[model samples]
Target: MNKVSQILVGGALGLSILTAASAADPKPQDTVDYRKSVYTIIGWNFAPIGAMMKGEVPFDAAAVVRHAQYVEMMSKAAPEGFTKGSGPDAVKDTEAKPEIWTNWDKFEAKMNDFQQEAAKLTEVAKGGNEGAIKAQFGKTAETCKACHKAFRKD
Candidate 1:
């Protein structure tokens, strides 16, 4: 009915889907598919915020908060997507590099950074302070760049 209610409902549905995916004995390809879908959803919610932040689109605090919520949720959801045996070698269609499985600790640290920054971005967005939101967005984007640089392939 309301925006908050919609977010909660949507998030609950996403969590349920994630739970279902993890509960089953997924094939390697299936795991890859799941992770790809997760990232796609993250990118979907993330692009508009990025455009707004870059001044390519008008800044709307309400839109920023909504997008930040999805980004934060997906950042938390992302770890599950990087399961063992789902790397590019196994999947063949992912941009995920071998270092993800080989240098797991470092990759995990980057992921943690992303999750923390994403959460912080959501909090900053809720405050309706453009400067703080922009700063947090930069921090969150840095985490993404760090992770992508270390673990993802071009």
Candidate 2:
């Protein structure tokens, strides 16, 4: 082959190998599983923040501020990670409920609302005002309550 032909063939071969590598990788379901693991980690890490917010634990503004990002992240994350059996057994033992799956539009709306509230809470917390944080925390908590009431198992 001419030099130019060799270069072209090499580029094509590299592209083909890249495509094959990606195709051999895990599918969306596997990706979903990975995201669920991340969600679990975020949940565990945020427990302290939750405790502080509710005053069960001592107030730690820094910790609350740090974990607020995870709340926003998990809230904004796609629901693919929330598949029927994707969570911890304690919280994940049951199906996500037929209503959640069947009425996906409403479920998604609630998720979006929660995400917005979390973002608002993060903003308020970042300002370092306990009063504002408490108020916004209430709003954020209400979002969780609303969604859980509608979609989560008792």
lDDT scores of the candidates, listed in order:
0.83, 0.68
How does candidate 1 fare on TM-score? 0.82
Lowest summed lDDT window (length 10), candidate 2: 16-25
Per-candidate TM-scores read: 0.82, 0.65
Considering only N, C-alpha and C atoms within 3 Å, which residue pairs clash in candidate 1?
none
Q: Write the per-residue lDDT of candidate 1 for residues 63-110, one digit (tens) a residue.
A: 999999999998988888888988876777889998988989999999
Which residue pairs clash in candidate 2?
none
Q: What is the C-alpha lDDT profile of model 2 across 49-138, one tens digit per residue?
A: 667767898887877788888888777664655665443332434434557767889988998998898898778778888778888877
Q: Where is model 1 more than 4 Å wrong at Cα?
A: 1-23
